[model samples]
Target: MQNRPDLAVGRVRHQLKFRLAQVKRVQPLTPHLVRVTLSGDDLHDFESASFDDHIKVFFPQPGADKPAMPSAGPNGPVFADDQPRPIARDFTPRRYNREAGELDIEFALHEAGPAATWAAQAQVGQYLGIGGPRGSFTIPTGFDWHLLIGDETALPAIARRLEELPPGTRVATLIEVEDPSARIDFATQTDLYAEWRYRSESDFPGGALLLALREMYLPTGEGYVWAAGEATIMRAVRQHLCTERGVDKTRIRAASYWKRGVEAVHESIDD
Candidate 1:
């Protein structure tokens, strides 16, 4: 439990650094979602104030037991020339308790890759490395309502917003899951009206989430929207919001967590 697993702990600066942590516990949220709790003294200063903030999870190489920690370079991350680059993937921070030193990250057991493979078999005392989330996009809370849309991969971020948003904020959620069994409940104080669309019941061309968005009614007044999941569908959703619904581009945030039919970033690294 080194203060800084990959670099010396800073005495003054608070820049994000690589942290070495071990799995303390795991919880199966659903048949296809697992929550892995990573903890260590190195997380005492972990900062993830924004609901949609992400962290880079580093996994052990092919046959290694633990991930190789990267050192902070003058301008970027630096690794040894001979060392195999550990598999890394972006994951949202579901929860972070600095006082108790704990970080919870959820994995969508959808794709087969080093990150998902590691999370699926993660057990107590298993080492993992995390870094960055160097910045946060703290959305303004003045919106009259909020619209959230996504799939299993977006759950971590969706859940975070629900838990942290103002209790009185009105939120409309449209989530598409693998099946009915994948639907989940949340503990939050936001004024939420949620709708679930099962992929098993969806017709292609637009998929469940986009179709749901098409049929549902968005709340009135100035509103904010956040959507994530398959890249293609996300693009369509964003387009619809901008062109069809007239939602201001600045007030909507859409991201592609992964692309359908393509190997995840970890499995198909580009040269």
Candidate 2:
């Protein structure tokens, strides 16, 4: 009899650097999602090893032609006190093509934020600054199946994971969007079972997603669960999975991409 391979998660650190890039193209993937492609010589060596890896995008201050770039400091990045600081937001590197010197980032237009506003009107030749992914958490694909859960903000990462999975891999996804218009197709070689939940007037962020997860059927055998969305909901998800579903804590990864009434929130739920 053959033995199943052991599943292990790995982490890799990256050198931090900021690069300047220009908007090469902008396309609307769905009603609430806009994809902006940036190109630059600096992206030649850019690395995004994990599907959920994030890059800090810097936006120009109001009425400014370009963003104020930051310099490396002992503690972290240092901004000039004399100059207006640029607005920065965290976004997943949806796609990156090294030879073509291009990187794709998708923005969720559900809310009014600096990044979303910039992406909504992003035009070719417009310049934007991007910083490091800093690190990557590599999850082994040798598990029996994978469960992915998230909302519109986590779409890019979920889509990237679906695309990267090996053939015959089993993955079940639960995605929450604004409405039917926000739904889109995913291209993958894996055995995919995707379910979409639409939000209503009374629903809170991740409300529909959590309801679906509670009733969804999990695949048999050892599997990994990856989820990201609102902060409060993610914490509940981790608890339910560990307590109700009896899933091992180490076999699950949950992240809070955003929080209610909070700006620039991105964190992992590991408690």
Candidate 3:
């Protein structure tokens, strides 16, 4: 059989660096989502090859003007012994313009967290620190069809993926949000089927995303499933797709964007 690039997954590693950036603009995209655009000369060489790529964002400590960034060590980031470690969280790179030296990261204000708190009060010209995406996990868009699922925290990645898909691609998105106001318009040229589930309507721990997934009919063809959100919810989604839906494990990608009551949890779910 001929090699199928549509089924191929690519990984790319990037040079790691800690860059200090200033908040260029802060725009509220929805009632629960805010988009913060950061810009600096340090971002001129930044790269993010995947929609789900994450970067470590360091927030300034109370009474501090800028965050205390770690040095890039041989093994990884190294912090000074005397300085207070910066509060950091993994955030998806929503958009990046190398020519303009700007990066857009959307912050979900569903819960009170250091990142969310900082983003809500962010002001133009305020300094923040950002670390590398480190690497990228690029999924092939040439698949016959695609299924994307996630909650509020995964909106940036889901939106990016939808925008990147080429014309004629078939994609279905199941998104969970706090309420109807949280829904936002997505611009895409693909054959799209998008649904929004609301937590206000259901007492389900993670909203009605998984239930909707189970009841919906998937498109016919070889397809890839991508999901990210609360850890437990994502685990169940992955299990359902693999065991009940009969999708190959290799054709599904799931990530835990956050865990209830846990801080700074970002992990891939395999198995």
lDDT of 3 by residue, 1-271 (tens): 2357667888999888999999999999998999999999988888899997999999999999999999999889999999988899999999999888999999999658888888888899999999999999989998889999999889999999999999979999998888899998998999999989988767786658878888978767778899999999999999999899888888899999999998889889997
Full ranking by TM-score: 3, 2, 1
Give the Cα error of residue 63 in candidate 1, in Å.
2.5
- TM-score, structure 1 vs. true: 0.90
State the TM-score for model 3: 0.97
Summed backbone clashes in each candidate are 0, 0, 0
TM, every model: 0.90, 0.95, 0.97
Candidate 2 has a TM-score of: 0.95
Sorted by lDDT, highest first, which candidate order results? 3, 2, 1
- Worst-scoring 10-residue span by lDDT in model 1: 1-10
Clashing pairs in 1: none
Against the true structure, whose TM-score is highest?
A: 3
What does the lDDT come to for candidate 3?
0.90
The lDDT, on a scale of 0 to 1, for candidate 2 is 0.88
The candidate maximizing lDDT is 3
Off by over 4 Å in 1: 1-14, 264-271
* lDDT over C-alpha atoms for residue 271 of model 1: 14
